[model samples]
Target: MVAPASAPRDLDRYQAGLAQLRSHYEVRTAWTSGQERGYLAAPDSARTAALHEAIRDADIRAIICVRGGYGCLRLLPHLDWTLARTHPTLLVGYSDVTALHLAFYARAEWTGLSGPVVTEWGDIDAETTEPFRALAEGETPTLGSNALSPLCSGTATGPLLGGNLSVLTRLVGTPYAPDWEGALLVLEDVAEAPYRIDRMFAHLQHAGVLDAVSGVILGTFRPGEPPTDRPTLSLDTVISDYFEDRPYPVATGLPYGHLLPRCSLPIGVPAALNVEEDTSHLQVLQSIVAE
Candidate 1:
């Protein structure tokens, strides 16, 4: 979990949750600078590399960021994707970690998750626990709620990919941006206005990011606002307008993003998308790690 450079008020809770999480699987914690001023500042490269090595050598089945903040992108250029590819594992995080998720998908063609972090442990609600447990236990064909918007009705199958929209947008021209072709693109964001969302989508469309995808899955847009005066456009409208007459399926609200009881989706694994009934289902076709 990306602890702000400052000590957290709930450090004990965080530690306790970490302990519980470790009961199910091996857990390790690493950080750039414990006493640093900002969470986004670049991590010490030597130390960061060492931590990556430790994780790689350990043959860890999963890697979860302790938290999300600004500096994860700083480690992107230095990351050895070769090691990650050889030692395939479930790399998981959200928020700022979105940058890393994009890097993994683009560089390694490996599936990762844009789900809860260490901090989310203490806040775990019943709604989230089942899916989280299922993911950890390698359950397949997970089905989720249909509360999200439905732009079109259809089913498409491809690898799952995406995370925080803002972070995804940040890597637009970079080598880390995902190859959207034949991929089920899922996205979510927090604290942005509808206009900002529209602009980001516009950017993706202009960059040819959206056109290549097999389908689109939109997660929660938390803390976002529609303009008060004008009847601002909804997310569904933006999606439909963007993918007008596109062949791919478009479905929203897969219970991901900054929401309780989120699905621990594998980013690079082939999965089926069924939107005809306004439901999205993901089935892990094979193990993400070598035995």
Candidate 2:
């Protein structure tokens, strides 16, 4: 497993999940960091090389990142994508891995998994793991936002794009920034306070990013709550402002992101969003695999 970010706090926790993943697949881990504690995977080093090689391996159909703390952003510039484009693979992970997802989308138009990583695989249930398995098995996987309640009611269709709100916002104006036009942006994150969420949303709105999207799918916003302080703006209020007077469909409670049993989602694929009649649904319109 590549340490594309902060090394796992406890090696054993990650090892347990690695065992679980191997149980399901012919896993070949790239221990690029030599089982080191805390990362020193500098650019163009073994750490970055391992992931690039995996993406380009003709026989390795998928690449699952082991953990996501904070680091993939630094590895983006150093990546070599020729082999990856020639030999496509499913790259999976969320949080800090958002950098890699959008980078791949912009550089190669390669759709990848914006889902749970290895260490996060503890207590994997059908509700969570099934979507990812169906995706890997190429069964025209579609994840439902059954947990989501409508925030703004409407129906829309566009390419599904976005992950970890903070990571995505960081890419704004960068070469790797995702094209927001006609995209159904799905966003989620963990630990950030509601105001910080508000700030990121504001950045997008001001940058004309929000206006460029057809709709928004709100995934599990970590704590899924507003601050306890009375003066604090509820996450609902902060988000609602972005959609106010706009017709974009907005909804929440998607079982993705930092939530348990997180469902897998494909980046840069066409998907339909329905948020009418008090219900919210997302139907991925195509298999993400390239023909």
Candidate 3:
């Protein structure tokens, strides 16, 4: 485990998850200033060193993030692309970790997992752990969801990309942002108001990102604050206002994001989305792991 973003707020939960992980594989922690409590897991120098250490270590096949609150963007410029390319370790985490996944894809043409973090292990159910296990074991499982609400109808295929909407929006115009052209943009977030969500969508639309993707998979957008008496647009309304007419297909309720039993999505892997009537199907086209 590495604290590349924020420090784990709940040590008990962190330890419990750590124990569970250790039971499956030999786990090692790349702890630095993150050993102390604060908003950031550590200073940029310490966090960067820890990440580099993990990347360069031959024994560490994968580096799992402790949590995601903030601080990943700060480590972007300092990341050594050469070390990452040469060592090629898998990175695992989501939310703010999206920055790392995009950076690896953009800079090193590497793939990572937008899956559970260490702190979430204490309460993760078997269903949630299954996808992560499948991916880690080199199995390419097709995640088809007849339960998903298909917003647009069509079939599209591209490199599966993107993560938290808020985090991805912040990456716009940065050197780390991935090329959205011919990519399947997966997005989800938590706690943001509908208006703020709309604002981020508007930002992406204005940036030409919305038009460049092959399709969109919308995950859980859990409400942050309670509803206010002030007039507001519903999330569905806000989403439709932006993507209702897009040529590419758009599907909602991907069964990922902040909700439990989140499926592990492979960043930069080829995937296909088929939407017809009210159903949406997602199929991972190939193995993310090398044979």
Candidate 4:
């Protein structure tokens, strides 16, 4: 899928991972161009067209994005929502690929995977990929964080939604933006400074999207040290400023997101979040795969 910028540097690695995947499922690949590596601005029309054709193919059971750098937004206007709605399998990826997840959920309520891309296959430890593999085999995936710190402890449940904060916010006013209402929102981002995170949260709040969320599951915020000048606000303060007063639970410590050892989440599926006893857990309440 490589919807965003491609990772030609990992072509051999991607092929090896795909070959491994093929041993497990009826794997398929789409024709792409050198431009898809994002050497140029956006992917060629042939690459985008190939993606459209792949989705409409009834035989395709899932689409795994190759990598995420930057390019999905440009391709959004070019996708065919009609053919996309007919897509019966899971859409998988994270980071910039969140654009496609929100679009798929918004346009047709199709399930999406907020997990590893093909380039990351080498890092797929069993602890991380096992639940995803189980889900791929038509079993409902189970997720639990080893630790969850409570901001507002309580219990809530709703369809799971959200992805990389920067990417999700990019779609806010667009037609592809998801109506995050009645959702147990899960959010994670990488490298963005605390103030930038605060601004994005303010944007979501102003857009009236947070009003729809029943609870929030926070994942890794900064995969590395945030580049900030002195007197920088704490990310915790920013999160609490937005979430502490909410009636629903707001918790952190999800294993999914930019860090290693992650699990794939079924976007838009019902989820249960409990923050009672100062401990927390989130569970998908229904099956994502069709029987």
Candidate 5:
């Protein structure tokens, strides 16, 4: 484990998560940070060095972040893409880690998971971890959600890309921005007001990201506390204005992101998106880990 973003606020909970990992697999920590440092888990130089060490270590097959808060974007310029590409280490985490996922993907074509961080593992139940376990074991599991609701009707097959929406929108016009062409964009966010969400989606549209993606899978966008002081449109209303009549497939209520029992999705893997009148699901076409 490495803390590339924020350090765990509760060390005991972090230890519990480590115990859980040790129960299943041999676990190691390259470095850690304490809350004394303030917002960043560690200095950018130290975080980048530790990450590079993990990347070049042949024994480390995967590099999982301890938690996600902020600071990952600061490490982008210092990342060793040549080493990362050659080593092919899988990265795991979500939220602020989305910056790293997309940057590694854009730079080295690295395929990682937008799943639980170490701190989150302590609280995640079996069902929540099963999909991640299956993927780590090289099993391609079909993620079908009965709760999926289609906003637009169609089917699309493409490499699955994307994570936290706010994190992704920040990459626009940067060298680390993803190749949006023919991608199945998966998105989620937490604690943002509906207007902010609307602005980000508009930013995507303005950047031509919306036009390039083959499909869109909307995940949990848990709203922040509603404003009682003014009139505002509902979250559903704001979102529907953009996707309800898209040319490609679009669906919401994917069981991923911020919430528990979230499915672990592989970035840069071929996947199929099916959105029909009464059915919706995503099927992984192949294992993310090469044999």
Candidate 6:
């Protein structure tokens, strides 16, 4: 389901991209444009019913958003998660879609994928596309990197959860927010200042969100910059201080965010985080479903 804030004129490009991705997969149907423009803010009661019916009728195995904007939260309350629970499917998206993922995670315990969308589909490199394909086919994909902070030199296993940092932070006060306990919390963001990142971490610490998680996997904080006015803490400092003395392992520098060669991670799947001598590895234990 494509949930865009506003419809773009470049529908041709969008269709071509979808065609490219479909060339690699067996896509039977596609759903684009919700009931409203620029976010389906409180989709009408009828439209809500239509949404549920469409999903049910299509028996969608996977639902990917068109793009991320600011309106996903509006569709949350109107969604019939009870119905969704009965007929579970893979929900794939990122950025603003993080709001929806949090809602599904907390409300229905639904596992989703934090990966590419329509716009990013064909544009992604082959390396990035391979992991996504592996995930969609219910195959476990192991993610590893040689560059990392090496916070804890051991392995931890739990359900994988998390996405864009700013989007995840927006759920801190809401019921949809995830309880990070025993979860490998992966996080990434784009164009955020280092100080702002520090402040958000402070908020997480104050809320006790960081302590409950089994481990931390830092994704690419793309276009991150330090403050210009005064000396500021680095992303590493923020992470080190937050996870210090915590029981779970904390590692950074994974290629899973708004960067080239992004690794597509299946949220709500049992996964292992192995921090070895020279590399960190993330291995999915099962598909993100009951099957």
**For every model in order, what is the number of clashing pairs?**
9, 0, 1, 0, 0, 2
Ranking by lDDT: 5, 3, 2, 4, 6, 1
Q: lDDT per residue, candidate 4, 1-291, as tens digits?
A: 434545546678777667666666775666443554445224558557767777877877778877777767777788788887766568788888888888888887787878788777765778777878776666654466457778888888888989999999999999998877778888999988888999999999999888878899888888345555557778888888999888888888787788887777788778889886546788777777755
Could you give candidate 5's per-residue lDDT for residues 185-253 as a string of tens digits? 999999998988999999999999999999999999998766889788899998899999899999999
Per-residue CA lDDT of model 2 for 212-257, tens digit only, reads 9998888878644554664677777777787656678877778788
User: Candidates' lDDT values, in order?
Assistant: 0.69, 0.79, 0.87, 0.77, 0.89, 0.74
Cα distance off (Å), candidate 1, residue 57? 2.1
Cα displacement (Å) at residue 63, model 2 = 0.5
Evaluate model 5: give its lDDT: 0.89
Off by over 4 Å in 5: 33-36
Models 1 onward score TM values of 0.86, 0.92, 0.96, 0.91, 0.97, 0.87
Task: Please write out the lDDT profile of model 3 over residues 48-158, one tens digit for every residue.
Answer: 999999988888888999999998998999999998888777889999999999989999988888899999987898888988989987887777584568888899999
Who is ahead in lDDT, 1 or 2?
2
Distance from true position, residue 81, model 1, in Å?
A: 2.5
Error of model 5, residue 85, in angstroms = 1.2
- Tens digits of per-residue lDDT for model 6 on 1-291? 544232333667667668876877655433454445434422445435544664576456777766676666666778887887777777788888788787787887888888887767757778888888888888886776655566777779988888888878878877778777888888888888877887788887778788778888888886466657778877667667776556777778888787777788888878999875577778899887547
Give lDDT tens digits, candidate 1, residues 1-291: 333112233567668668767876777655434445444323346435643765476555677766676666667777788887776666767777777777877887666666677767877876776666665566564555446455667778887878888878889998888778888888888888777888999998898888888888887776477668878877657766776566777777777787676766666777777766635454566544444
Best by lDDT: 5
Clashes of 3: 1
Give the range of the ten consecutive residues with the poorest summed lDDT in model 4.
Answer: 33-42
- Candidate 1 regions with alpha-carbon error over 4 angstroms: 1-10, 145-149, 226-232, 277-280
Q: Which runs of model 6 end up more than 4 angstroms from their true locations?
A: 4-12, 26-51, 145-149, 223-227
Which order, best to worst by TM-score? 5, 3, 2, 4, 6, 1
Query: Candidate 6, after superposition: displacement of residue 10 in Å?
Result: 4.5
